[model samples]
Target chain A: MLERGEVANSWRHERWDSFRLLTPNWQSRLPGHRYEGPDPDGYMTMAEVTAFIEGFAARSGAPVRTGADVTSVRRAGDGYQVTTGGGEFRCRSVVIASGACNVPVVPPFAGAVPGSVEQLTPFDYRGPAQLPDGGVLVVGASATGVQLAAELRRSGRPVTLSVGEHVRLPRTYRGRDVLWWMDASGVWDQRFDEIDDLTRARRLPSPQLIGTDERTTLDLNALTSMGVEPVGRLAAVRDGRALFSGGLRNVFSLADLKMERLLDTFDAWAREHGRDGEVGPPERFAPTRAPERARLQLDLRGGEIRTIVWATGFRPDYGWLDVPVVDEKGRLRHEGGVVDSPGLYALGLPVLRRRRSTFIHGIESDAREVIDHLATVTLAQRPGA
Target chain B: MTTVANGVNVQALLDAREALKGAPEAAQFVWRASSKWQDGVHSTTRVKEFFGLGQEQEHKSEAVFDADHPEVFAAQDNGITPIEYLLIGLASCLTAGVASVAQNRGIQLRSVEAALEGKHDIRGILGVDSDVRNGFNDIKVTFTIDADASRQDIEALVAQSQKRSAVFDALTNPTDVTVEVA
Candidate 1:
């Protein structure tokens, strides 16, 4: 991110603050802290998360089982029995956490490109170091876009990220994590069942702040600083080059100017909203934009980029297990926290109680509700005593 | 055949796929088979290419065997057989999902198994079919999630597996198959 000009002003300051955090871990009477993302908010670190999970498991007495291959599960009269290589273990409920990617979305044109044209799915992505260095294009533009573009740029790879519409947020605001508001405000709290799936999936306006009360950024300046040109959406991938849409009519330099103008427009809007009593100013603000259906086509196409990172986001896969809990389009069917199947349940799913159901922070709250329900349902299933 | 749904002339995709031609070009992946699972099952078999970037090629091969015929057998690559590899991947993926979710959820699973059955209407594969169902109709995966998890739990597991398995993604989310004669 620092390489890509994505750091903006916030990153510049964090670079120094990072050393301060390292001091704590130095055993200076206090614990040494790794200021994980230059974000000053001190959101729960990986260590904290691990500790929490360990505590929860110890409290619940659920023995941690790893790499145990379970063959099947059948009903044992009132309860259930599970068969695994680790031997049979009984459980009242289950939370299937098989991450989505059930199927590789093998694009049709993948083979159309020359054999030399390397292809990889986000599913296969490990890191920027692994990519065959050439001007690279990343296709999707959801959370994956901003992060991948920043990482690759730092690695000194001229990278282009092709993003569709997406929701953007900053790392912090008013000394608090942007996630704080994203969760508290209804912006990320709306339930998926409350709206149509289309509305649920697309991006929307948000109060999520960016880096500590410092400065914020959009992708425009970031890609340019790393010499990672921004090309339009990929139309087709040929042998040596990929065909693209938008801004091809003019010189590539003109494209960069367009990004600047868009950022300027975004800042101006934020200022206006701040004054208008609409969206208030955060202790800090991140450069961001909500996909405007109107200005979208009208907005001048920005500079040409080499690759498109499909950070466009993820989709759920349900092809092997046969259950009717899924609806017409193949997503699980559930009302709020209740699932379609009896003695079966799901939680921490995207858009469950609200749009935030899928967010990292929201998962904690969702898990609480789910575990509670599981306890209740398990007791209910006990032979109508 | 075309049908109307939601007032749109929806080409029956399943039928169109049935009508769709398989690989217009004849290409194959032939490996030397060492031992036979089936006696008459040709020690050497062929994989017909249905679509996407490959030369118009025919595959043929001989069989290689270990010292003990009854002991073990392996096929040496004539070349990369993408389809065969994909089929194996699909089967493996479905089975893995079944097992993983079962364990994570605390479901006592005795045995989880899946069988892959591919359906490629001859017309679709040969490009002779006026009706399209170019790809396999259904890759049936019968998940024998042991007998432990209730029929309900097992069924849900199966559904979750099917819903979450990536192999199924490769199958259902058919990538655009663009072909050009270079």
Candidate 2:
């Protein structure tokens, strides 16, 4: 396997802070034996996680060519030409595990926010200590946005959060974890085809939940009450002034409605299955108030506003692949990770097959399917078959 | 050549800008409104709005704003409350700013959504606490703009609009007010 960075799971390299997996421990996600380590509540730091993967790789004796950044992959005679930073390797088939979070989607405003005001994406962010001393504007209030904003606020810096439309779910609803409830509710088992709006479903932002010391939920309301300035959606920036939208009320309303519906669904399911004890009582709904400023323009030039961290999420970049399999929107069009371009395949894409397809626990099924397809195709093309 | 896209007339805007540049006095405008107290917490403000300065034709329109409360305060359940009117005024002004900016920039916007929320502590208004302010402690304006342009582009447009907006300026900065028997 050709690895792009020096280490496995290169995305986690820049992340200096400690975090636990959204789901359970390594043992549950990765197939096979047991993880005979400090399995304290399943949550672990990046260091511990990387060590586990390295140990797995060592045990399996997998020939991983690290630092091999694949520049392009083109079709050869009967195989494929995999060009990389180091050199080239001709292979029969390619399993593209580049993962979705390959490129950070920084909005255009980052460029205009004055050279003095530092702009950092989640990919570039290390920790709070690395930032300049001043108020920070954390845009795109999803998983990274809320977490980073909280972390920074804890670090003794004022944080202004630019909220977005996101799915809000409590980490622990009843006695059990929300993930457990979702699994029991057959949410993960839901297939891509079963979804009414595939595009919308596929593009759904991850639920606004945090799994740090424990599974905790964070939303605009929580953040605002916690002293974090929950502003409207970031609209524009001109002449060192950051402009926020006037539709914050609607944003809060939508998020609140989603949360209500989600909890209601879970409640109904619990009642039907006689798991009422497992489901907790209803949460009091308090919508976030939109600021009075119809258009909020914060002066970034004054130096009070130092850093602008964009946690707007990421989109996969498949530009390196020299194949005609990419769609107009720059996404790989595939049927369960198996593309129409014979030997080429894409794995670890969200909504590839099931809901958990792109997740750590879900990638295995996608990989298996791709491997099976590759094997079948290879066998059919064999000389004496 | 100036381009026109969203609801903005670029040529007309350019002409206005040129007109303002040639004669700065013509750019000045004044808006007037008269209000009468009905009862407790109830007042009616009559607005015969007119567009002044540099225009060949005098434009006029009539509008009314009635402020009242439900059971909370001692007033008949009438039109939207005064604070609500303030929010509406701010919302409408900003929304106009967004539309103007989008149009001026030639952004083919799919939809423009704007909302305003104000946080208030009634202690100051009721004279329960001397420290508490009489108005909204903080107000938040949120917008969800679906446009062909990038998020940054739209944001920049909004910022420019805020800097240029009359209502935005009036609220953020204090304005001199004079009261006398008329």
Candidate 3:
């Protein structure tokens, strides 16, 4: 396998302390793969996660050429020609597991936020001390945004959370972790075909959750109540000032409504299986609503809000791939890991096969499917009498 | 009858502002609402002839309320209930305050939308919990407004409106109520 980054799992090279694997320790690996390292029960840090990936590659004895930085891959004869910064290689099949979060997407107004205010994406964010003296304006209230806002707040920096449309889910609901319910209720087993609106589902934000020692729920309401100034979606930045919309309440309502619907689904499932009694003790976490102001403009030079962290989202970069497997918009077109071009396969995409396809647990299953397809294609193209 | 904007007389508002600037007691106003029970958990409120519009002309609005439950020791589904009216009152009061403050600030507002949500424990209203008060545990008001003003200016206007709103004052403060059999 060819790798682009210096390390195999370069995505884990962040300064975040508590990076919880979405799936628990036991389920966070390939099917036949096992972690013989330390802390098999809890989460792993960045170093630990990197070491784990490196250990996996070593155990499998897979010929991984790291630091190659593949520039382009094109179909050559019956195989493919992969060109990287270092050298070139010919391969029959390729699995694109580079990950979904390759490029950080900042808003267009980021340029107008002024050069005086330090800006950083979660990709390069090391810690709070690295930021300037003044507080921060953390845009996008996704998991990363909330986590950073909370962590920064804990470090004595005032945080203004600009929340938008987000999925609000309790980290632990009904005496069990939410992931457990997702696993037990067969949520991860759902295929792409089962999804009614793939566009909306693909764009849905990761649930508002924080992975701590003991799971804690983090939503806009919770953040606001915890001294975090909640604002609307960022509208624009100009003249050393930032503007925000009055859509905060609407976003909060939508998140609450979605949470209610999700809880209702869980409730129905529990009742159907006669496990309602066990999970019947419902916990109310309704956030207090406040009057939404129309707009907010902050003076960037006013010794307050010295930094801006754009946790908006990410887009995959397929600029290097020279195959016809990608669409006009650069998104890979694949059906259950197999690309339309036959030999090219995609893995670790958000909801590629099942709901957890991009998750650690789901990677193993997706890898198996790709391997099966690769095996079939290789057999068909073998030497004949 | 002279034409008015958003049921507000700007000249009268200016007059009141000026009058209050010189003598604050000159701006004293009183509002009254008379509601009568019609049937099970249903009532009608007649609001008219409020003081301090710079004139004593009669303007009336009749609002009805009906509990959304079966007619027993229970609520009956009819119309907007009292608590819902409370939310409406608070929202409308704050919204009007926002408009007034914006106008006073000379802000050209494009659009203004307000939403209100309140949470109440049914046990309090049902008298099941003697310790619980029969009122909303909390109320949240959200306003989405578009105006050609800076964020600080808009926030200042909202704060000024909240400070000057009569309904806000009444809700936040304790008042004596006299119920007499006449």
Candidate 4:
């Protein structure tokens, strides 16, 4: 395996200071390296995650070359040539596992913001201390955005969180982690092809969840109660002023309604399996609350907000791949991870093969499937025995 | 399963969606209306033709509608006001979506009724209150649906309808509008 840096470089460098695995430690399963640490129910900090991955590398005894930045991958006769910073190697089959989040996606309107306001994506954010001393505007209400907004507010910084469509999920439900119910109910194992709307499902933002000792739910209501002002999606930036949508109420309603449906599914599953007696009674959370009139505009020149952190999500960087597998939108054109090219494959994409494909516990199955396909193709191409 | 439910042609809807995926540009539509002033807060708008499926198409018949404020606004009581037309559009779109989604889900509907209330201060347009909005402060729609499904299922149907309604999206999200004069 070739790595641009040491093993678990992203975990060590990209994540915020307070970052923790969204999944419980118990779910951190690889092919042969199941998490054997104590506190299986607790979340692992970034440092622990890095250590775990490095340990896995050591124990697996896999041949890995660190500091090998791949420059390009192209066809070379019946094989493939991978040119890296270190050297070039030829292989019959190649698996691109660079991961989905390689580049931060900032909107074009971000350029209109006054040069006075500092801008940063989640990729560059470390902690509140790194930000300038003033109010903050965190765009996007995904997991990263909400977490940062809450942390910044608690640190005595006024925060205005601009929310779009977001998935609201509780940390725990009915005396178990929400992830537990999804896993036990077979929701996470749903195949990509089995979904009704594969396009919508794949594009869904990450849920608003936090991994802490308290295991508290961090939703819009929670943010509001924390003194963090909630606003609509950032619509435009004109004349040093930011315009927000007037759809905050509907956005909150949609998220709450979706959460209710998910909980209903869990409840029905529990009843069908006769497991209701074992778990706590089904409970519902308070509906999200919105401002009577959400503010529609904010002047960047007014010195109210010092920094703007964009948690708008990420996209893969495939600039070095000398292939035609990318689409007009820069998305990989693949059926579940099988590229159209005979020997090329992709991994670690959202719902690439299954709903759980992006999770650590899920990669084992995907990796196994890809390796199996590679073996079959290599065997078919071999000379007769 | 039968392709017909609640009088909706489910197979045709699905086929159209599939076919459009291959020719996305054909799905772009331009609906239009031409209005003529009829004096004193009144006007008549006619709808006849639209562009869709990569060509111009016409309605079965040209439909004319009139708009005017009520007598309280010191104008002759003509037809319903223009704001009322917005409510009509939203209601029609959501109702259609509910029926189509119900048909797709194989839920037989007995009856579906909707009541919509649009609360407008009107002071913004009158220039009496600058803080108030000219449009409705908020609109609420309640659906009383009797179907062969449970209460949660019915609620899910309505929610799904709103999720897919184009008018609802346009109302909730911002859209770029340009006005040009020749």
Evaluated with lDDT, which candidate comes out highest?
A: 4
Residue A343 error for model 2, in Å?
1.8
Regions of model 4 farther than 4 Å from truth: A382-385, B1-4
lDDT tens digits, residues A196-239, model 4?
99988888899999999899999988999999999989988988
- What's the residue-level lDDT of A361 in candidate 1? 48
**What proportion of the real contacts between chains A and B does each prediction keep?**
0.00, 0.00, 0.00, 0.32
Once fitted onto the true fold, the runs of candidate 3 whose alpha carbons sit more than 4 angstroms away are: A6-8, A14-18, A34-41, A276-280, A291-295, A377-385, B1-182
Q: Residue A23, candidate 2: how far off, in angstroms?
A: 2.3
**lDDT digits (tens) for residues B1-182 of candidate 3:** 23213444556777765678656555666676777877776777777767763545456555434444444435666766667777777788888888776765567777778887887787997789996768765566667888877765666556556656666655543345689998
lDDT of 1 by residue, B1-182 (tens): 11211221223433443454354333232222223332322243334322323443333543232221221224343332334445676778766666655654566555656666655465775579766555554444555557455665666556555556666555544335656765
- Structure candidate 3, residue pairs in collision: A290-B141, A291-B141, A291-B142, A292-B142, A292-B143, B69-B75
| Candidate whose TM-score is highest | 4
TM-score of 4: 0.94
For residues A1-385, what per-residue lDDT tens digits would candidate 2 score against the true structure?
A: 8988755666357564755556656324555523566653455567766776777677778789988989999999877899999998998778888877888898876888889988989888888999999899899888788888988888889889887666776767765677777777777878877986576777888777676665566766677667788777787786678877655555666666566667777778888888886456755556556555433557889877789999898888888988888877678878778886777787888888888886667767777877888889865785675
1 or 4, greater by DockQ: 4
Task: Give the per-residue lDDT of model 2 (tens digit) for B132-156.
Answer: 8798767778888888887656765
Error of 3 at A82 (Å): 0.2
lDDT of 1 by residue, A1-385 (tens): 0011221121232121111111111111111222244433433323443444444445555555655644555555443466666677565555544333234344454455544445565555557767766556665444445546666777777666554334444343333334443443445656565675433353332211223123444344444555545544445545444554432212122223333333344446446546324443434222322222111111112223333344444555655334456666566666655666555566656566667664434565566676677777766666662
Report each candidate's C-alpha RMSD, comma-separated, in the order given: 21.5, 13.8, 19.3, 2.1
Q: Which ten residues in a row have the lowest lDDT in candidate 4 chain A?
A: A376-385
Report the C-alpha lDDT of model 3 over A1-385, residue by residue, as the tens digit.
Answer: 7776655455466445555554445556765566665554455556756776777777788888877898999999767899999988888777888777788889886987767788999887878888877689999888888888987887888888887777788887788777777877777788887996565676778777776656667776677767788877777676787767544554665566557656766777787888867764656667536445433557888878888998898878888888877766567888877888857888988888888887777888778877887887764675570
Candidate 1: Cα lDDT at B139:
48
Candidate with the larger lDDT of 1 and 3: 3
